[model samples]
Target: MQTCEVETIIQAAMPEADIDVSGEECNFTVAIISERFEGQNLMQRQKGVLALFEEPLKTGRLHALTIKAFTPAQYAEMQNTFLVQLES
Candidate 1:
């Protein structure tokens, strides 16, 4: 699946997220920022994302995926931000 479509599925689950996805079209490197991730541990946050793609992964529609997930507060601390690029 295209990263945009994958991102859309994730966004449906976590509407506040700002997501950037790139890779070999199927394999993906994803960066996500969302308030829903706040206070959640790394495993939980990753699980939330993985849950969204369970079927795709299981069905082999997606080959591999790497994810970087962050809470809005943590994302704000990033020296370079993704949301600003999206807004513009």
Candidate 2:
């Protein structure tokens, strides 16, 4: 429900991941970075995270979830691009 709680759940599922969660009570956006996603396809990567919150999703405690998953290298690249855009 809360950002920290969502973050904790993702962290539990992927202990080595770096997770950032944001949004209101029942809706959330999550960004997860980990080597575990390296060879996976996009659907697989998204499914991996969605599976962690099955119960909440089923119970409607979590209404909406938007997820972005990437490997560490991808995350770094994205961050660099964002920074460049800000400077432009």
Candidate 3:
């Protein structure tokens, strides 16, 4: 349930993705950027990430997971918005 372990699992499933994970044991928030998500809808993207943690989730080893999935362009847009907010 460590962030690194969660990250590892996700990376194993999607090696090309760029992932950032935070939070403590049993609970995590993940932000993932990947081309694989380009044509997928929100739920589809979430499911694709969540599916990697099925065992941990089912066993309660991972209690809560919040996911933010995006394509590289989407992530860049989000980052730009964040920077603009910071400047304001």
- Measured by lDDT, the strongest candidate is 3
- Go through the candidates in order and give the C-alpha RMSD of each one to the true structure: 5.2, 1.3, 1.2
Residue pair clashes in candidate 2: none
lDDT of 1 by residue, 41-77 (tens): 9999888789899999999989888989988778776
Model 1 has an lDDT value of 0.85
Q: Give lDDT tens digits, candidate 2, residues 1-88.
A: 8999999998888899988888999999998899999999999998888998999999999999999999999989999999999999
**Distance from true location, Cα of 7 in model 2, Å:** 0.9
- Candidate 2 ranges with C-alpha deviation above 4 Å: 86-88
| lDDT (Cα) of model 2 | 0.93
Task: Superpose all Cα atoms of candidate 1 onto the true structure and report the RMSD in Å to 1 decimal.
Answer: 5.2
lDDT by residue (tens digit), candidate 3, 15-87: 9999999999899999999999989999999988888889999999999999999999999999999999999
> What is the total number of backbone clashes in candidate 2?
0
Q: Model 3 off-target regions past 4 Å? A: none
